[model samples]
Target: MEYIVEKIGMSRTITVPSQAVTLLRVLDAKVCEVNEGIAIVSYNSGKKMNKTIEGQQKKYSLSSEFNRFVTLEVANTEAGDLDLTPLADAEVLKTTFTTKGRGFAGVMKRWNFGGGPASHGHRMGRRTGSIGNAEWPGRVMKGKKMPGHYGNIKNSVKNEIVSFDAENNIIAVSGSVSGANGSLGRVKVAK
Candidate 1:
């Protein structure tokens, strides 16, 4: 099963040897539909819900409508046999989220390409040179690195859970996580 969480920023653990950790806030979720091996869950954000969502929530007998919805699938367990509360006991989790948008970037910043020398007469410094070859393969390679859009892409990272506050709906995980603060994240058991 997957749970919707919000990125709450990064912090350092207070252990003897401090380590970086990412804080995540578990949003309120309600099961909207239950099937054989799939369940539809709705997550509540700070924003107000629209009419369409409100109607769906009413149909499910939920008091409040949610801002986002996620479909969770279990291998062999039916919806009735699943328990969403197990997220608090997860040791290792895989988090999927979008990273911070970097707009248009150059090869140096995007791909860490070694640019040309900055000395005088080197007008092509910091530029991606030799994009093509001779007549044999005149066109550029398919996966050639070039300046273009970077970040804001969906990425998954496996993190070790440092701590969990079930009452407060907060989870602390070791290492960095994708996305900026307040960005949506999906957390699930690491395979």
Candidate 2:
């Protein structure tokens, strides 16, 4: 099953030394329409609402808070509160989120290219070294790691479940997930 979750920042477990974990909060969702196994779920997100969203809310007879709608595979048989029972048994979760954007980066920071030498001779400081090819193809390689848009891309990672607090709707995952705190993302039960 898929659920909308928010990144609640990172924390460490209180054991021998410590173990890093990322906390995620599951947003309350209502199943609006169900067909086969896929359903259209509505959940509260930001405060930005539009006429289209109001129309959807009116159509579904939902309140103003449930403004954002997304289609997900749900365990609900009919339209109502989304079934959270599947999450209780979820051990592995596949999280999908957009990474923090680093606009127009250099090769040193973007691709981690060892910049020029520390000495004061070469002029390769944070610049692309030699991108031109010998004259065979007469063009830079297609997949060359040149500076461009970095981050803000959709990334998916699998994390093991550390703990789940049903009362608080919080989940602690063993590894880190992308995106900043309070950013919304989707979590799928991988196993």
lDDT leader: 2
Q: Which pairs of residues collide in candidate 2?
A: none
Using alpha carbons, what is the TM-score of model 1? 0.86
Query: Model 2, residue 25: displacement in angstroms?
Result: 0.2
Q: Rate residue 163 of model 1 by lDDT.
A: 89
lDDT per model vs. reference: 0.81, 0.94
Per-residue alpha-carbon lDDT of model 1 for 98-144, expressed as tens digits? 98999999999999999998988888888988889899678988999
**What is the C-alpha lDDT profile of model 2 across 37-129, one tens digit per residue?**
999999999879999999999999998889999999999999999998898999999999999999999999999998888677877677878
Residues forming the 10-long window of minimal summed lDDT in candidate 2? 117-126
Clash count, candidate 2? 0
Q: How many residue pairs clash in each candidate?
A: 0, 0
